[model samples]
Target: MDVWPSLREAAARVDDLVAALPAPGARSAAQRAELGTARDAARTLRVRYLDAHAEMLYERLTAGTQGLRLEELVEAAGAGYPSVVPTAAQLESDRGRRQADKEGHEIDQGIFLSAVLRSPSAGPHLLDTMLRPTPRALELLPEFTRTGVLRTRSVLLERRDGAAYLTLCRDDCLNAEDEAQVDDMETAVDLALLDPRVEVGVVRGGEMSHPRYRGRRVFSAGINLKCLEAGDITLTGFLLRRELGYIHKLVRGVLTDRPGSWHSRTVEKPWIAAVDTFAIGGGAQLLLVFDHVLAAADAYVSLPAAREGIVPGAANFRLGRHTGPRISRQVILHGRRIHAAEPDARLVLDEVVEPGAMDAAIAAAVERLRSPAVVANRRMLNTAEESQDEFRRYMSEFALQQALRLYGEDVIAKAGRFAGRSG
Candidate 1:
């Protein structure tokens, strides 16, 4: 039996069910039951569709059509039936399947790398790949270095005592990221890693310049909700630029030592996050990837993406590694706030110091950690903690779920509410 036709029929049924369901207010028992039934059926159909889609992609990959673009293939796969054939639900399902496939590919590549490293002849080729930028990374360099938008620098790179400090300087929005800031940040990270003079790296938020947060420091407020509310950033752009581009790049850069490749690297410089005031949403997510975190006593952290109706980038993968699964779930699902003084905060933060003493504490930490032995130990610890296979799997899952949440209806509604408030 042809599965594509059946998948299309299932998708149509899901669309019909969604149309029949009661509108967004409180629902009666019968309405709730009907909605639940529809959701269950849709979920099952979505899984089947995803599996078939994966099979089709595999066929294409094995049939000497590796030149075909992934997005184009996905689009071609869904080119049948009505406008609602590839609904939000189906798209999300497809994303998950694609992510899994990507993880598998990366794992195979990593196995190849390991084999090459072990070989007497191919080890130099692996190092060359690490030292140079791949074609895809080169394509993204324009986004990283293009300047002319904002007068002030969003990311400031400073060198002190053999350490490179990349400060988030967008105090106007409490260090909330815009496109320029994201680009600058990616550039700063790249420069820091490539600079041989830099032995260690520190990332911190600057003192707020806005009236609302005057004289105070903030790590970041995550994505600039004002931009989202203003429709300056569409759902597609948010997924591609912010989630996949900026946040993903920063996390991968810190965790993986290499300049290129999505797979985690065996050698990476240790990174420290010196968070002050508040680390909300994307800011808080950044802390998860850092090797160590030092927060001011008054600083508080939260993954407010739940409130914003979106997924916090990479937080789903790394939060549980810092905090336990329970706390991570609460923070992600319930918008739980963790203050520096709280015991649970210790999971993510290595130390909590007096508000005015954060800089000194960070300096001391950097002084102690900026050594060749420390770098080697860090790489060893990272390898022991999680393999490249595990990292690839987590990132793949994160990319899919984050993309779906960014483009989902709930986030759109939340953005509308934010726009209303700003207006």
Candidate 2:
């Protein structure tokens, strides 16, 4: 069959099904499963069509927003959901809900995200906008001295002993990454880097509530797959936002408007990751970016996003630096887990402490990382490892690739399986 006709038909099926579904809320478990299958086909066609006409659509969508900074560009799109979205998405309730929910419109957002990065002028402008602290960060900065604690929905930042303890607090899902965590983590990191009292930053996960790992601190379980199943994780809100947001800030340091490259004139600090039980998928990706890592003796790390049909953040780009190409491929492609105290994790783990000794380990690690040369050499090492331009290029492609993977059949199927097993 011809591509246009098939694409149109596929989209029609989704619209028809969505219109017929109950409006009180989302579909039932079974209905959602049905929708999942249909959405997969529809997304595949739409993504292909979008890719084919990316240039034409990109020019029109970004015309008014051209030359605008990243923050300004989104505001220009619209106050909220309507702006930057396609006519087709605008005409439907699901589209409106998706935009409102901050989980839909990945196809357009993907293209727009890529266009912004690929543009010669807007690229740096976009990077500058994202690399800086969020407005929330500024708001919380004042409170830092009062409590030396800045708390967000999914993250907690505490300033003490000259170290900013940046704790990931999502015990409900073993500290998995969701949109909320992504936003809050960025804010916390900003507060840490901004604080004059903080000489170093320490990242570690909170205690888990799940019975299987009850009370144990898990580094992270990666993207909230259950949320992924519910279609809650969005390309713009989570995936793309993260690579450029906190994760980059963690590696690049919090940036502000300056005359020179973002790398220089920095407020950056060395960070140490205290890996607890495990750092799976996105968690594992985080290990590659830290200046130092202290993994629990029993802790292990793995990149299993590919198994779920999703990109595991920047792990693909930076893992090779820590684990070589062969090891990176094994972990990323084959879902290999590198346990601490083993040869595989030796390069990544600065030290592997017993689970009970984590606090002492972190305290010592903080002091070692606070050496003046650390702050002095952080920017140099980060730039040498992955320059802003190199990252921009990676993100330019990742925007499109991850958008498709986020909505792929395999992702949906795996999410369903996870939900079922949990249920």
lDDT on C-alpha atoms for all candidate structures: 0.60, 0.75
Q: Which tens-of-lDDT digit does each residue in 1-423 have in candidate 1?
A: 445565456546655755565543345678757755654454455445443454343344335432222233233434432321242344543343312111111211222222333333333322223233223335544543343111237877776767778888987778877666765765566556545567778999988878878888789988787665543443333433444344443344432334664544522467889998889988898887677899999999999877898667668877888788999999999999999999988998999999878879999989888877877677667667655555545544544455455445577677667645521
**lDDT, model 1:** 0.60
Query: Which regions of candidate 2 are displaced past 4 Å?
Result: 1-75, 78-92, 95-104, 257-263
Q: Pick out the ten consecutive residues of candidate 2 with the lowest summed lDDT.
A: 94-103
Kindly give the stretch of ten consecutive residues in candidate 1 with the minimal lDDT sum.
100-109
> Which pairs clash in the backbone of model 1?
none
What does each candidate score in C-alpha RMSD?
Answer: 9.3, 5.7
